[model samples]
Target: MITRETAGELLARIPVSVPDQPEGESPTAVKASPFTGAERRVMGILTVPKWQQGMDQGVLPRAYQDILDVVRDAPGPVRAKQIAPRIGLPAETSKIEGVRSKLKRLVERGWLDEGTPGLFTPSHAWTANSAKSP
Candidate 1:
């Protein structure tokens, strides 16, 4: 009978770590992805560059912009519960998941970054480009 609250607490106690290292690095040294060679090049390609069009105006329509606005203003990575109130949803419990779903879509499209597992932040690309706008 593990309620969500208890499960979350237990999960929090567990330490997070990557399984293995890249090449010659010591196990305890925290490889943490040096992003050497082609790895860096490929990752750069995958990331949406700030210069890409439409991002300044915000890529998607109203709701997506609403959610992005919340993330943009967050001082740090924020939990979904913290985001619900500002999402412009219909003030129903079910709206939380809807908000989460929109966030996921934004992540996929390179508009957001999942900075830590469930936590989110505006993608570097988005913030960088946003600064260039008037």
Candidate 2:
């Protein structure tokens, strides 16, 4: 068994190589924006519950608002099974099926965009409105 002193010696014998940077290019740091493309405006996220008032004016049922919120935040198309738990439904087959039905209704009503079969995303209008400053 090697003692601590021998372990130190063994480690000291190892050579470490620094990654080479481009010959003349200095390292540049990228600045991070407060919001990524997928992020809704701070006001919009805060007012999602308030947005529901607008939805109510449009005749959409209140139950659909949560599903729409999940779709709006997704980076890409999402399946109902994936959206189930976000709205607090258990991830069971029945729950997923119920979500699927709601998704179809939303799609039909133009709140969501249809991507690949069984996949749904936020509508362009929804994103545009939510991203507006105000």
Q: Best candidate per lDDT, number?
A: 1
- Poorest stretch of ten by lDDT in candidate 2: 45-54
Q: Candidate 1, residues 1-134: lDDT per residue as tens digits?
A: 46767877877897766576567766678744333221212212422222243345343456777788999999998766678887655656578877887777778877889978779899888788788788
Weakest ten-residue segment in model 1 by summed lDDT? 35-44
- Which ranges in model 1 have alpha carbons more than 4 Å from their true place? 1-54, 90-93
Q: Which residue pairs collide in model 1, if any?
A: none
Task: Give residue 102's lDDT in candidate 1 (0 to 100).
Answer: 70
RMSD of each: 14.2, 16.3
Instruction: Tell me each candidate's TM-score.
Output: 0.56, 0.53
lDDT tens readout by residue for model 2, 1-134? 45767877876787754355555554453333333232233323322222321233133445577888788778888999999999999999999999999888777655777877898988766666666635
**Model 1's TM-score against the true structure:** 0.56
Badly placed stretches (over 4 Å) of model 2 are 1-59
